[model samples]
Target: MATDPNGTTQSDDAIDPVEEENVSGRASFTASLLTQGRHRFYTLSMPSDVLANTCVVEPRNEDPEEGFQRALDEKRARDIANYIDAGMGTIPTSIVLSAQPAANLQYKRTNRTLSFELNQRAFLILDGQHRVFGFRLAKTSLRVPVVIYNGLNRMEEARLFMDINTKQRPVPNELILDIKRLADTESDAEALMRDVFDLFDKNADSPLLGLMSASERRKGRISRVTFNGAMKAISDSFSGASAEQIYDVLSAYLICCKSGLREYSMEDLIVNPTMFKALMLIFPTIAERVNDRHPSSFTVAHFDEIVSPMFQRSKRAELSNPGKSPSLLVDSFRKALRSGFTIGGGNAV
Candidate 1:
């Protein structure tokens, strides 16, 4: 460790980006830049228990696009709720409004009375907005687990959001697409999500992992091995996929067959055997569609299109013939993959 001329130990602040290369063997300037933010202590944490759901997180009206998007999500929320209920799950709760607060509103904890600007705007949730909204509609207790941030600037929040996500291990394209659709309307969404992600991190040890066939086992192993190195691995895998897309496509090819439009859920899609089996079915189709196409040309819409045929064919096998195999539907999916598709992108705005 180097010492200052005055004898204090040199810290990250003392590193001279102008003169050194980093331990990663990149120019020291790049590493030094990352450490610069270390001196800025902006984060504050409070007990997850004390956090109240007082701030009605309404959609911000400043952005017209936000309102339209919120309206669209509202449309989807009902469908999500139906699916969650059928599957015996719950979605996340929601606030009455959505916005960042300049600071958290002060309130009497037990009495639950607002002490500050009782009528003023409160902070909208950045993440898990749909869950909060859904749970509120269901008339459950409003208090839940959350990480409330003070002075949450939009750009900085976005940056912080992505930063926190990078802490997790990588995921498959289909796997990421599947979980991304989890609506706030699952029966016990927070718990379901925890169970789902817990299973995902633990690998194939969970019941859902057993859906893998011998061939799919080999393929999944290869895919995970190939993607173990980078963040882009998860992005690239999930880049051209979506929760709806993966769910619709995979629901057709299932063998053990648990997840369905009737039983659709964050928990079911992420950890149910039917969902895992569908992933096995989608991957190779994705590879064929790409055919080594332009790198930028890759997208989640392709994955959605890959299974459109299955979705179209099996809208309600529930009433007509629920027991037979969906091989015909799977064949239709393969054909759809061969024909190619055109769909758009994800916009969580």
Candidate 2:
């Protein structure tokens, strides 16, 4: 430790850069000059142990709840330390630092030595707090990279941090595309459709459970993409209904349809996307007529009544032919529903 004229002790190993470009007369640190976008800053490579001793993290932001930098996460730090110990090549990105003008730090260009009269707390970490914490946890003497912005006020430091995070580090294109397919937030209808698809995937009572493409393919015959498309194709059919309500109605209908069959596999119906799409197109009309008589009392019998005539007219035996298009079954079912089916008591018309 070296004592300055003001009686403040500083690190004896404090370094000064061999080259520095003066900027606005506040560049008092010797460092290699680097430019990013329009901002020029100083870069330094220092030992991890030295940085642990010389720097301190000061958490600052306009909104504490939604701040850019957070408190040192010890769990994350320990994980990083363990990662380093495993001999896995972990690249240490640049840590950002800032110092206020009140610190009275000076750099002598000739000898390339920094003369400072302040303690470690005089410095602020604008970014990479977790990395420094990790180094402390590791207790390793590894070299770390850092970027310094001298004589910056709190506002300037925060702005620079925001710029470095939001403006420079863009999200990868592949990630955006993946997110688009997974959780598309284009419209309310798309969001609701995803929720309904998830309902089919997760609900144990659902006939389509474990058969939708969202679940593991052990018995899941439907592809997630195809199921989502089917749901979107008929999204407007369930206007004003909540996601759970839509799921319940669909689940009830499928259960009824399956119960009426003497012997049929849910997997068989799910495997064909065309069959699912045809169901989507036909469900709305059937649901309206059944709900009128049953009035929220949906049952397997009601499903039988609605589906029996349609099945009989469609000559579903023809469905076994691989050469037949699904539209044939769809058209026949639509015609049967229009011609009206008997509900055991009388004609549904």
Tens-digit lDDT track of model 2 for 30-147: 4465667766666666666555555676554545743456667799988877766666536568888775454356655455444333345545777777777777778456767777
lDDT of 1 by residue, 1-349 (tens): 5687788886432343232222232111111111235322112121111223334443445465332113226645455445444656543332222334533433332322222222224455545545544543442232233334444455565555456546645554445433444644334432333333334344443333543321122432322222222122223344455444433333332322332233432223333233333335445555454334434343434433333343434435321332333344445445544443334532111
TM-score of 1: 0.29
- After TM-score superposition, the amount by which residue 184's alpha carbon in candidate 2 deviates from its true location, in angstroms, is 7.3
Best by lDDT: 2
lDDT of 2 at 182: 61
lDDT of the candidates, in the order given: 0.36, 0.63
Candidate 1, number of clashes = 32
**What is the clash count for each candidate, in the order shown?**
32, 1
